[model samples]
Target: MTVTEAEGDTAAQAPMGSSSYSRFDTDWLSDATLALFATGGTSPLFATSSTVEVRYLGTQATREASLSFQGPALFDTRSGCNFATALVDEFCLIDSIGTARTLGDLATGTTLDFTLTAQPQPLGSPIDQRASAESFSSLASARWIDLGGGQYLLGFEEGNDASYNDMVFLVSGATATLPSPALPVPELPTGWLLAAGLAALAWRHHTRR
Candidate 1:
């Protein structure tokens, strides 16, 4: 479950400044095979054609992974390391909605594997917290690799749960378009407040795709 995100199979490159970054525009048809699995629930994992942007912030020396799609809510709680930018090649945010929403750094092999962990909560509880339950349950595990040249290999188990663990799904696709890194990154809208948790998308419901 090791994923490598880098430029060719060479030394890693850092974004010269805040403006330098890499943008990937997804091609749906190339990945239309996403329908071969079941996706929907509290953690709706998707390999469909969505906008994915990755960039390195020179000031922080950390990379950002952004995924924006028009669909139902997928992620809820985000847990891992806090915002200090010290750890390398480890889980940072299971889900994020801020500028540094991605997992990985300026170095190679930073974007490793992704796992889905969840625990049931007692009803009528007024609070929702991460790891509150002593026995945390593992829902699924996936392996993703960055094949360079704006291409990626994502393999995961669909409908993975206590009942299903025998199915695995894999997908690959090249970006339809890329963005010029010379331009400055856009700013988030004013007052776009995020919850206290690490930045992950706050999605609204949509019709099944």
Candidate 2:
């Protein structure tokens, strides 16, 4: 069973430092949906076109601009360029050890794209170690993007594996009330039965009149 930390386990509870240097973490945010498919033994493969929006609630400390959240945990793992930052907007982080890096220099779009070959040195080191299973597996292929407006939509699925490709845009907005167990929605036809019947009744009454 792939165990997760207790509910209260977060950057808030750890003895972390200001946004100064890079800090490694075992936990990075994965789409709650992905966590389900990629359970302890089952790794969910992100398809091309699978996108999600994320929100970042700013953090402050002692009235100083202390960067919060586990930034490097996600920033270091950018296999094949897994994320992008918007133009005019840059990806910045102050690690627990006071390592600060920006993604603005890496991408050329309002939003950047992922290219395994086009990764930054500092950003690539942690990811490499993780993927090799030589370091914190958490850092392996797991870097966070600067979700614009504090949120982003990340889509990169293309029919199961990496064969049939589409741009899974990492757009932002929309939160799943419950992230686990990807929720199902009623098909349009199935859900419209009542509305369709109501419309039919009104039409019949009008004809009778």
TM-score for each predicted model, relative to the true structure: 0.23, 0.19
Residue 202, model 2: lDDT of 100
How many residue pairs clash in all the candidates, one count each? 6, 41
- Per-residue lDDT of model 2, residues 119-198, tens digit only: 12222224221221122121122223333353333322212232111111122332222124445985778559889999
Off by over 4 Å in 2: 1-26, 30-100, 105-109, 118-148, 153-209
Instruction: Give a tens-digit lDDT track for model 1, residues 1-209.
Output: 11233232111222221212211112211222222222312122232233233222111112221221122222222222222322442323322211222222222212222332333333222332222322111123333334455544333332223211111112233232332235688877555544412233333222332
Worst 10 residues of 1 by lDDT: 22-31
Which candidate achieves the best TM-score against the true structure? 1
